[model samples]
Target: MTLQNDLQSALGFLNQGKFKQALKQSKGGMKRHKSHPDFPNIAGISLSGLGKHRDAIPYFKKALALAPGFHDARKNLAQTLLFLQQGEPAMKLLERVLKDQPGDQAALYLQAQAHLVMNAPEAAIVTATAALARDPRQPRMLRLRATAWNTLGDEKAALADYQAAVKVNPNDADALQNASLLLARLMRQDEATETARKAVAVAPQNVEARRRLASQLISNGDSAAARGQCLALMELDPKDTQVLEMLARISSRDQNAELLPVAQKALKAAAPRSLDRANVSFALARIADQAGDKEAFAAHNDEANACMAAQTPYDYEGSERQFSRIMAAFPDVITPAETAPEGPRPIYVVGMPRSGTTLTETVIGLHPDVFPLGERGVPAFLLHPCLDKDQDFTPEAARDFTADDISRLPEMPKGTRAYVDKMPDNYRLLGHLGTAYPDAQFVHLCRDPRDVALSIWRGYFSGSSLTYAYDLKAMAHRFNLYGRLMQHWRQVMPGRIYDLRYETFVADIEGESRKLADFCGLTWVEDMAHPERHEGQVLTLSNTQVRQTAHTRSIGKWEKYADVLAPFIDGLNPEIWPEIKG
Candidate 1:
């Protein structure tokens, strides 16, 4: 065959994704037409397509050597270098290409990717924005810019760009998946679930999309659907430890015996000291607990916690100092603002994780006049500049909140008297909340330290914020810090904060719920006592638990593992839990 015919055949094979065939055709063309840059460039493209990125580098270099001004070969080499994580060298080559062809969108997109690889998210945003300006319908550029925004912690901007990308290209499963995650994080459960469903429909075989859909289904209290998704995932990869863990989480007592053996197999296959191993161990612990085998439960629970602790060690002293600063910052009572911000009243439910915060919110949400906004980070996000820095927070920071800050809060439904913000970590931000909103009411949930610690240890937390939860000693220290901080708030804001003990609340649901309702200015209704009947979505770890009728089964649950929790029990400060005796 002639040189042109061979090159055309190779190009056609490359376009058809037949990488080996393309490589063979291009190799034959190179032998016939020696020193042809196009032949070497096409060979490099085929090699890169076949995942031989290292081997592709030398061919691109040869093409560039034969024709020094071959921009396509230079761009191809730059991309291969990026795949190899050599961002600096790749960046230099892209700059040269852009210098030669200033309006090349392909080079610009790759340059943005190189910026991301270099950890320069701001620079990536600039490059992506320029490309997007020229072509607003470019979904790739939109998604790239969205990623840069997410890296800079601007979730709203990231979400907007992601949604825009999906609008431009409806079948983009990756953009749909990312948008769904942002929606879930923003406490929009129904929307998140819907978006996840679209993603799964667009890419039926995508494991991550299926997993995301299952997680959203679980959050929305659809356990049966989540189990079905897990089963599908198992069919895709029978040995997937994550799928096994999800099955274990949503399994019923009757299903525990059936799932236990599968979870054990996954544990044996998991890597030592890895997150997957930790998750499998947690699953085994759950199975054992359901089967009423306390010894096995303790063994697996301890193993899971040990693996997590090795991965993320807590900074106890640093946390102690932070808590101390928070306490010192609010030495005196924060009087309500002279003019309360006019809008729906906010009921702040604050406590440690697994302290019945979700349960309390569920009961309150049963009132027709209340809207449940689950676990919003708006308060923390707005106050982060003041509180999360090296400097100590001052009373002046509270007064600095403006109309724009209040406008950023989630909108309330029509005719709603109040909304609940049930983020448990808001215990640390009571002073800011109280000073900013005159109509805001704080309800503090308190549970036994031992129960809370054990629950946290067994739970799978996703972020660095809860690193203290994996270790018994760190949990105890954090419990003490929380106790002291709550005491400070009580002393400073007398009559402003309501303390609701989980045990007490569960014992007399109607009577205690009546007081809670009255405190929040809601009329007494029978539905308030039956939170299980509430139709709103729950997006917390207690999603499934809160759907069941209120019970005291969880109270004093740590007693069953008393022998295993001896170290944790000894670490607790007596001052914090005067109820516990030696």
Candidate 2:
């Protein structure tokens, strides 16, 4: 064949996804036409297609060296760098390509991807928007833009972009799955379920597709359908720990004794030190508890805790030091009138994990004038950047918050009197929050330390922020720190915080609900007692418990596990012991 024909044949194979055939043709062409960069670039593309990203890099570099002005070769090199996780170099090269050829859609798309990886969603949005402007119908660019919107917490924008992506590429399983998950989070379960079904239909053999379908079904409270998906997933890969974990959760939810054997098998087969082993052990413990095998339950529970503690050791002293710094920094608290930031004042529902944060947020959110923002880190993000952690936050330093810091907060929706931030751990941020939004209403949830400790210990937490929760000593110490912090807040700003005891709230929902509404400057309404009536996803471990009517079944649950919680009781503060124990 002529050189031109050889190139055309190689290009056809590459475009058809016949990587091996393309590689063979390209290699033969490279030997015959040693000076051409296209053959080398094609060879790199084939190697990359075969998952040899590192091996592909040298060929890409060779192509770029031979033809410095070849935009295709440079773009190919950038993509290969991105595939190999060399993000900085990839981004620099992509920026160079875009600088030279201002409307290169491929370079813009890859630059957007690089920004997403770097956690710069704003930058990603800019690049992705530019790409879409150049070629408005590109499904990948639409999906990339959707991701940037999602990361920016603009779900409506993300949903619109995802819808556009699916319209452009109906068979895009990832777009379908993302749209479904977002819909689920937005509490549009029916639409989410349909979208997830479409994803599974499009990619029946894809484990992630099945997993997402199962997740959507779980959110929709369709355990039977979710279990079927889990079983199908198990058939595809029985040893998949995530599938096993999902099966265990579904079986536990249904209280199905028949599935106990699956949990046992998973526990026995999991590696001794793996997080999966710990999770499976916890599942077995719950099953054992249900079976009335107290000893077996305790053993499994302890093993799981030990595994978790090993994996994520608590920094108790460091936490104490940080708390002390916060306390000393803001010793003299300013009154609500001193700081001046306008808009609907924030109501922070702060407490320990498994405390009444979700319940409190739900009840308060029921009020007509209140909007629930639901567990945002915005306050912390703003406040932390101003704090010089090494230096104490003196009254002078506390006054350092400028209007620009406050302006970063978005305006509340029209007619909303206030918005609630229900981050449970915001208990630790009360002092800093007071400095930023002195007029901010604080609703602090105080639960029985024993119940709180037990609940936290038994639950599955995903982040390092709660590393102390898995061990009784760490939990008790953390609780002690919490108590000290609360006491400091009360001392510094007397009568400023509305203390909502969980037991009192649970026992007299209507009365506490009315009083809380009064505290938040709202008139009493009967609807305040039915938090479950409110819309929006609850994204905490308390999600299941919060959806039901207010009940006292969990009031003294730690009593049943008293023997297991002896250490927690002993380690708790002597002054607070009576109230917690009773």
Candidate 3:
């Protein structure tokens, strides 16, 4: 065959994951045409096989330079960019490829990939949707579409796409594996388990598929099946962090200690990524607590304290003022939002992150009728109309919801007698909620702005949404806005708002718990004392803390990190501290 034909054949071999065959074919092809345009592309693929990411970039670029229309080389370059941690630029590069070749299935797929890495689900969905429109049969595109939908808070849409992706490519291990994960998120445990099985059925070599299946089985409450899946996965890839995390979970379940180190080592080897740190840290701490090592216990405790950083309180007067405007403009949906809800009168968990809202919610949830569903962000998703990108909340907007808006609550939350809506950032949407459920209870949860700032700086939230979490001054400005708007809510909705202090919740748990229960229309119960009893929902980054139930451990936990937080919350008006403590 000619040099070009041989090079194309080599690439086809590479695409099939036949590294040995691809390397041989590529070597032969390059020998035939040492200076050919495809030589660099072939060499890049071979280098990538050796885990030489940095070295592969130039070769991919060379291929593109020689053959400017080489779409495959561009895709490889984008992949290399992602590995280099230059994700935003990589996305732009992928976008350029798509612009040059509209309807290019591969380019579109990579673009969706870059969006996911950047944590922009809304953007992910838009790009994924366009990609899907052009190539519905591409299983990877379908998977991307599903992930994008999930990020957009469209659970049903995500499931549909996942299903389509797997159905179109049953042996596509990645598709099956990812589809199963989305199924678990949708709470379809049994189906997810089955889907995970199918994933491994095709690609038993794909370690991640096995891990995903194992996790789904465990979530389904089928511990045995999950463990079996874990075993199969370990046989395939013993160094997988997620699989190790699962093994640790199983070890704990069976009262076995051997798997603990195995899990820890795997995670550490993975370089301690961001998303899984909260869960892993909590589990690791639990492991240490079992070993009777006080220092380990202290470190774990510190981790819990550290996790609160994502809970940055508000900043900027404009944000809060805008939120207040939104709340005031909020039109009431439920005609009798005031009725049926009695007791602690529903302690509405308000305040920005690091504002002690979690502590407040934990204390209150301990009360008999109070359910501390950690960070159930459903309220925030449904109350989007009230969220203006940058516009001040206008009363005209609040009254604009139609019948569809009012019907949302009964549809979303299914069954519950006056449950607490703990959407922290909901302060901005509270007024809209007021109109939606006019009679629904409210609690303007707060904490000393300084303490809130300190709490945030010390804490490490795995799923942070803003850049503010990493910047103190800017974060403080954000906190000021949230607090100030909260202040506005108290003023306009006088006698309607009550503040719960994070510090006071620990200092006076019983009293606060009692008051909080009453606020939320719940009859008191002794079980509320052990907030740890209510577990299993991975609602937010505080999964570990919520799992242990609410306690005073996190309260005043930032005393060590105090010096760091002082500058941020100190900028906020002091008027709110008195309100939170009382």
Candidate 4:
């Protein structure tokens, strides 16, 4: 064929996805028109389509060298560089492309992708926002911006973008699944379940969509529906570790003994030292603990801890430094709040995780006039802003409270005389709470530290912020800080704070429940002792436990795992152990 005819044949073959034929035709055309940019560009396209990206690079360079102003060839080269993960070079080329054509949507999208691949999420957010400003209906651009926001730890912003993406394309599976997960993390379980269900409905054969639906179901406390979804995932892929682990958890919760072997068999057959194996091992540990197999429990618990700890080890020294700074500021900063109660007052129930914060809140929630805002994180948000340039708190910061600051606080339920904010970590922000809400009261829930540590270790927590729970020494450090901080609060705000010991409450439920009700300024009600009957959704790890009648069996539960826990709790203060053990 002649030069023009040969190029035409190659272009036709490329368009039809006959990459090998296109490459042969382009080579023949190169012999006739060796100086033409289109010949080399066609060859590059052929090689790229045939999955030979490295081989395609030289041809793209040759095309650009021959036709210095060929925009399409430059764009193709940038895309190829991005595919090879040479993001710096790809981004440089994209910057050149954008200088000429600032509104080039394709170049902007690739630039954003390159930034994200290089772990520069802030840059990606800027670039992706530009692309979306040009064409807001583009689902991929919306999803890209959502991912960048999530990487920046802005979940609400990320959720907003995901919602926008779903609205742009209701059938977009990625957007639907992402929005569902964010909703779940925000503890809007009912809405999360509906969104995840839509994802599954849109992409029925997608394994991840179904998995998200299953996980959301479990979080919403619908174990029965989650079990069905897990079974469906098994049909999709019998060896999915997540499916196996989830099945193990649901089976253990349901007391379905036979299903445990299915999970154990898959776990035993899995390769050693994998995260999947570690997770399943942890699941089996929980089952063993429930079955009273102490030896099995100890062995599996160790394996799981080693695996998880390797991934996210404890930072005991770092944590100690941070807590020391917070405590050191107490003498100057831990004073009374200046603002009076503008509306419904808030009573905080504060303590370590699994230290009866939920139980105390549940008991207090039974009072007809008290609204329990379960584990709301408003104070944590407020405290972060008051830190100085060195990230340390100062007395000056504490005293700067304004009545207008109450506007920033989370709104209490509309028609209640008083509300309970039962965030356990509020123990760390008692000083801030004291200054911002002078009328606010505090309830400190105290539990046996050994039992507290054991509970935290035995259960799995979702966030990296709780890294201390994954290791023993780290847990001891956490427990110690909590004890010292509570003592400081008692000294600083004596009569405004009330302490409810878990052991005492368990032994004398009526007396302790009445005391809790009275402390919150509510008249004692007989129903306060039967918190499980209060008809509210508890969205904590203790969701299952709180729904059952009060029981004392969890008292002294540390003794059962004493052998496994001795090494971890060994660093605990000798003086504190006696106080808790008594």
Candidate 5:
């Protein structure tokens, strides 16, 4: 085949996600016309698309070498470098691109997302805002701004940007999907459902959108429709693990064992991810237990346990530095105005993503006098004063503060003394939380690092924001860093943080709740044992699980699969409640 034809085929395959084929074709094209003007450029695009990032570097360099001013090739090369985890180099190219063409949409979008992920949200917002100004209706740009807003603690603004993007591009499946997820959490059930429905309608063949809408419906108590949607999604992508898992979870009436076969099917096919396999196995076991098939339940649980991956310690020096930079950028936890607690009041629960945060929040919510904010951004993340205008935040994160902003913060709500901000990722800003409400008690929940690692891997998270979560070792390192930070907070900001344990809570709910109550300076409420009964009160992701109360079954359930946890089995800190590590 001619160089051009091979390149064309490579482009086609690249766009189709047939990376291997694209790589093959691009290599073939390069060999045919090693000297062609555009061949190197095509080779660069195709090879990078193929994920042969290192090999593609020369091609992009060659392309730029041949045509020094080719914006398209330059842009592709820059982004390709970023994809190869070469963020600094990519930043240099993007900066050059922006210097040349300040209003370049692709450059701006790429630069913004890149910066956001690299702990440069202020820079991301700056570029993203410029991108939006040039093309206000650009779906990607809008989402970029929304994300930047989110990272900077402007939940309302983020929602507004996302909503606007959805409005401008009603058929944008991603926009609809995110809007649904966000609104659902914000307690706009009807809007969330409608938005998700619209997303499914617009992209009828999009199995993901269908699944999302269905899940939202299920959460909103529209299980009947959720089941139908899940079934429909199954029809399109029969083995889509997410669809299969959701179906298995929803169709409990179809004989608990029935879903097992489906889950097994998805698992056998390597349907989506390892997490799905774990979830399916767990769900099947749950059903078996319900069905009185103890042996079968044990077996399934054991198999699910087998899915536990191994672990290795990560020498994530670069990541550590980046995290340090992010911490430096947003140093203080921006909190609501109520600096001093006059009495027992709303406590903000801040920690990492899966650190026993939800459980701690639920315990706090169990208090009769306190209201549960769940994970909603009420005194929202964006409520921080520094979010105004455009400032890319640094990882060495510091609060963008002013005396006036502090002055304007609302006083303690009439009678509500304790409000909980259960932003798990808010640990990086613990001091800010302290400053936000000197009187507010901050509970920093910690769990076994191994359990957190295994849990995250065995779950489907936003694979984008938390790139670290994809790898077990990275997850462990991140967890360790979090532990170090919490430990530091205790040393410096002692008395403000109450470390909660997952195992202790499981072993003795009453004991833990009373301890929690004492920590928050509240009278222990007897009703906390029935955590699920306070369903409406939970605003975090645990809404579904909190329908009744605490269940002892979840604690230490990892034992069923403890043997299978190869990758992250022992990645936890050696001193994590030394009594329990054994």
Candidate 6:
């Protein structure tokens, strides 16, 4: 074939995604035309298409060497560098391309991506916005800007851009998935689930889309559908440990004995002390627990916790120091604000994880006048930044959490007397929140430390913030800190805080729920006692549990595992629980 014919043939193959054929043709052309820039450029493009980014670099450089002003080769080289996460070098090359061709949308989009990879979301927003200005219908640019907006914590703006991107391309699974997450974050669970379904519908073969849909389904209490999604995911990647773990969770919840052997198989195949092992171990623990095999449950739970502790060791001393600082910062009684902030009053449900906070919030939300905002980070997000260098709460910090900051929270429905913020860790921020919202009521859920510790140990928490949950000693230390802080809050803010014992609340659901509703200044209703009847999403680890009727089954759950949790029980501070024999 002629030189031109060879180049055209290679280009055609590359355009059709026949990367191997393109590479062969391009190599043949390069043998005949040793100094041709197009041949090397085509070869580089083909190599990149074949996911050989490293190998493509030399060819792109050779093309650039033969033709110094080769914008296409330079752009291609920048993209390959980005694929390798070499953001700085990729950025410089893109800058050169944009300098030569200022209106190149392709280069602009890549520039935005490079900015994101380098952790410069603000720069990415600017670059992506400029590209979108040229064509508002560009879904890629819209999605890129939405990601930047999300990185900057502007969920509303992020949602808007994502929706715009979806409007431009209804089949854009990425935009749909992201929009669903933001929607869920904004307390719109139904919309989030629908959006996730749309994403799965459009990208049936996409594992991530399917996984997200399964998560939404699980959160929405559709376990059957979630299991179907998990089955599909298993078909997609039979060895995916995450899929196995997810299936195990669903199977445990449904008491599907068929998956017990599958989970065991995954556990055996997983690497020792690895996250995959840890996840599968947790799953196996759940299955064992469901099957009423105490020995197997203990063995699997111990292995899971051990693996997790190895991966993420807790800083007990650092946490103790932080607790000390928090206590010292609020040494004196904080008088509640005289005038309540002009918005929906907030009922803060604060406690340790698995301490009945979600149950309390669900019960409160059953009241017609209350809306549940599950585990919002707004209080900490607003207050932590205002803390003094010593990490002390300041009057200035209270003033800093102004009307504007309150606006960041989800809006309550009309006639709502108060909104529930059931973020358990917000207990640490009560000193600031109590001083900011005059009408705020604090419902502190107190569970038996043994039961709390057991529950926490049995479950897998996602973030580094909960590293303490993986070890017995760390759990005891954290419980002590929580106890100390709660005592301080009780002394400093007397009437504003309501201590609700989880056992007491569950035993007398109606009677205690009345007091809780009254404490929040909401008129007591019979519905408040039946949280299970409330048809709203529960998006916590205890989501499934909260959907069931209140039960005392978990009240003294630690008794069953007392022998296994001896260290944890012994480490508990007796002073915090005088009723228990340590």
- Whole-model lDDT per candidate: 0.86, 0.80, 0.62, 0.78, 0.66, 0.86
What CA root-mean-square deviation does each model show from the true structure?
Answer: 3.5, 4.7, 7.6, 5.0, 8.3, 3.0
Per-candidate TM-scores read: 0.87, 0.80, 0.62, 0.80, 0.63, 0.90
Q: Give the TM-score of candidate 1.
A: 0.87
lDDT string, candidate 5, 200-278, tens digits = 9999998768877887877765567888998888789775665665666656645456666776665566523265675
Candidate number of the best TM-score: 6
Per candidate, the number of residue pairs that clash is: 0, 1, 43, 2, 60, 0
Off by over 4 Å in 5: 1-36, 48-55, 152-154, 271-273, 302-345, 348-371, 376-418, 421-545, 548-582
lDDT of 3 by residue, 1-582 (tens): 897689788989788877667767876876787667687787788778767788888888887887888888888889887777667988877878878888877777777778778887777778878877766787777777777776666666777787787678778787777777666554455666788889888987888888777666554445677778877777786655455555555555334366666656644643332434544554565566567664664565455334433344324564556555565553342232333322222335777775656545655555544444445445565546446453433444444342333322222233334445566777775565565455556777555565565545434444545445655676766765666666666665655666766667656656766776676666667655555565333334344455454556655555655555555545444554444334
The better-scoring model by lDDT among 1 and 4 is 1
Candidate 4 backbone clash number? 2
Cα lDDT for residue 41, model 3?
Answer: 84
lDDT of 1: 0.86
Q: List the residue pairs that clash in candidate 6.
A: none
| Span of ten consecutive residues with least summed lDDT in model 1 | 390-399
What's the lDDT for candidate 5? 0.66
Candidate 1 clashes between residue pairs 3 or more apart in a chain or in different chains: none
Error of 1 at 244 (Å): 1.3
Reference-based lDDT, residue 561, model 1:
74
